[model samples]
Target: MYTIGQVAKFLGVSRDTLKFYEEKELVKPKQNIENGYRKYNRFDIYDITTVNFYREMDIEIKKIQELRKSKSIEGIKSLVDEKEQEVLKEIEYKKLILKKLQIVKEDCEKIKQFLGKYTVKEMKPLEIRGEIEHYTAYEEYETLKENTDSLKKAVTLTSLRRVIRFNDEGMLEDKFIIVRKVEDFEKDIEGEIVSHPKCMYTVIEDGRWSTGGKNTDHNVEASLRKAAIENGYKLLGLVYINLLLTTYEDGLERVFLEMYVPIK
Candidate 1:
């Protein structure tokens, strides 16, 4: 037998914690009848050690109490198995976040290499979902809303399509279509699925006005057209802008994007 303080010191726990276990009926220490002083025996020490083990495994105190009274090995195994599954799920979730962080770091690194540089590359066929703005129906809207989870995890890229056509006023008409590049699957997805082949690729920084206070989309389009012509390539009507990052620099909101235009 040992005094409460002696047991607490040996177990690396506080005397108050030992008292708490006694109050919870987890360890029934012998009490001095005259002075009502607590005395812990070997059995009480063993119970304290077992309770500490269960608490380390994140088992609730009430559940641990029930487990102590129950002599079912299968029941205890089931509880531990549930905790194991929870840990596995947590590990997988953290792994997904780590992968996303790596991809983000890689994308940021590309700003120096690809910004303002033009090259022709063979872009793989992409499966995209979403119609051009103003042409999307109610059913299409609901479909995009329904598969929200897939949009977060499985989608490769979120992009915008701009048609390089002029309106009746001899001005460039802006028609921005929001789309998401998804995994190629045989099962049909909602909205329009688009594909592209070889493209003229470049990275562009937008959202900043020129010194003359003008939108730079026209200048970018002209530059791409010039590059295409000079390289013996033909513009295939539309530009696909894959958004990379939206950030604030020099107190101005700016967008960094990877631009792709199909070529013949």
Candidate 2:
């Protein structure tokens, strides 16, 4: 048997936490009446260490006590399983935090280079009246894809969107193409006005913008036109998109889009 001081020295726990654990009927240490000091045997030491291990793992105190008293392997396994899930969830949360931190660090570097910071404002209604050549040419799709990929292979997508906006006088900015947040727009709107020869066809009200994936543009344009017409308004104008923000693959990267009459 060893005194409380010895146990504290061995395990690096404060004498008080140990006493509290004892008072809570956790680890039953032996007592030496001669010196009125709490004494602990090797068995006590082992039991205390086991309890502390569970505590450090964030196991519930009541659950740990239950595990200690319950000799069933199933009970112990259940506790271990719960702790494993908690640990996995914590790891996922930490990974997300690190990803966000990396994005913030990159943004800071951009500011250092006079790359400019982003801001938001309600867009003033702009007039856009541009003609669309039909026959569904995929040239624009190919060019955007090639450019976007090039941006990724080089300085990354962040630098690419900026370069595209600067060079493509044809590029729209600060505009978000608004799409209804329904799960599926195609099946929802009956007799949707899509697949038309009319180039000037949609208008966006309050909209959210997102990164341009090849598959999304046409559907969103079609959804807006239907939504507008369903709301009793004549959908007039070339399908022009407003990029609410230029975000390169990060959450909190502002995104929204609104369709407007394309302005030449």
Candidate 3:
């Protein structure tokens, strides 16, 4: 048996929350006869602990009360099964956010290279992009040339096509580009993974990763792998080099890629 204060101390919850829980009929504390104070027995402590754990797991208070009302193993199992997908999805989102943060930190380290002269600005909703399709890994270089040739022959893209940085949501499994047009969906796209530019990426400070394209002149994958290892995290997944900006230079079209890794 314990008093309200004692129970709160034992369970590491604020007395106010426990009182609120009682007021909500979530927990019914035993009554004290002499002064009509609240007394929490061992059952109350167990209930509070369970509630705290569920709350930490982001379970809704109303749902917890419903479970308490049903108080059946089958009902509890069914509720848990329904919640499993949501929990997993949230975890995946958190992992991607963390990875993005790490990538941003790395980019900030080499401020001049990544930012150039650009100042900070809020990102608006990404505009629609056009894309070419059916490019193979080996012919990725020639495919880019072909796409450029087509771009020249057709109406020049009035709106510059920029590759938008995308947070992985378990659907982006293939390496592809976001272009100004999608001419061939089945053949030209989803064929080339190595044709695009690659770079070595690493997190420097503030848990963000940035790719330095210095290794572009040499072995691309090896340099990127070295950078990943140097950053104190393993290469758990594929790195996405997003072509955020593009321009033509010296008979070569250069695209600035935002190198990214998904982390958990």
Candidate 4:
């Protein structure tokens, strides 16, 4: 027989916890009438150990009570199976959250690297599945609002890509296309299958636009045109504007955009 204090010490539990277990009828201890003290036998100690084990597994107190009353092996197995399924679902949800966090981290890194640099590089053609809308630069936001549903569905399903056409003077024309990858594309999606051509591209990081600065996009376009001419590379096809990041500060909207102008 062990006193309440001795059992509490041995089991790494408090004396009050043992008293509560006794109150719940989880463990029965004999009372010494002569001294009015609680004395726990080996059986009570074993029962306390069982309760502690289940508690460590995060089993609820009510479920643990039910488990204590049940004696069938099959019943215990069924409970364990249910708990296993719940654990697996939690694991899957955590994995999805981790994936989203990783994507955000990568975007932050890309934004940091592309602050004020312009470069020309070869890029592979991109295949996307999303709705395409034709609108001039002046009507860009209005068109986006009109196609908000399509944009939401596409963004929810995959990554975003912007495709824009330019005129003879290297100015953005009145037509544009927005698309996302087709891997997660739904069959009922009302969008065009567009491919961004593979070629050498004049890449400009439009960090200035993020701070609500004026003419950032125009500056980038002029820079690309100047670079193309200086390097003797012929500008071809539509210019694709990829949004790297967008944030709000001091009641103003900031945008980090990248322009990919295909060149030869």
Evaluate residue 74 in candidate 3 and report its C-alpha lDDT on the 0 to 100 scale.
81
Worst 10 residues of 1 by lDDT: 148-157
Among the numbered candidates, top TM-score falls to 1
**Candidate 2 displacement at residue 227 in angstroms:** 35
Runs in model 4 with CA error above 4 Å?
14-39, 120-216, 227-264
Q: Mind giving the per-residue lDDT tens digits that candidate 3 earns over 104-161?
A: 5664454435432212221222223334333334444454444442322342222233
lDDT of all predictions? 0.71, 0.49, 0.52, 0.65
2 versus 4: better TM-score goes to: 4
Across residues 1-264, which tens digit of lDDT does each residue of candidate 4 receive? 999999999899999888888887888899989998999899999999998987887777787889888858888788788888988877877786687678668767766775555566534444443234533344454444454433223323123456656766655653345454444544655565544353334334433335346656566667767777787878785676666666666656666665666766
Per-residue lDDT of model 1, residues 10-70, tens digit only: 8999988888888889999989899999888899999999999988988778988888888
Give residue 134's lDDT in candidate 4 (0 to 100): 38
Model 3, C-alpha of 201: deviation from truth (Å)? 17
Choose 1 or 3, whichever is better by TM-score.
1
| TM-score of candidate 4 versus the correct structure, residues matched by position | 0.58
**Error in Å for residue 125 of model 1:** 4.0
- Backbone collisions counted per model: 0, 22, 20, 1
C-alpha TM-score for every candidate: 0.67, 0.45, 0.44, 0.58
lDDT digits (tens) for residues 1-264 of candidate 2: 888888898899999989988987789987777987887888899989998998998988888788777757877888789889989978977785686578667645533442221221122332221111221333333433333213223312221111011112333432211122123333543221222223232222222234333345445545544555555544334344433324444443434332333221
Could you tell me how far off, in angstroms, the CA of residue 120 lies in candidate 4 after the best superposition? 4.9
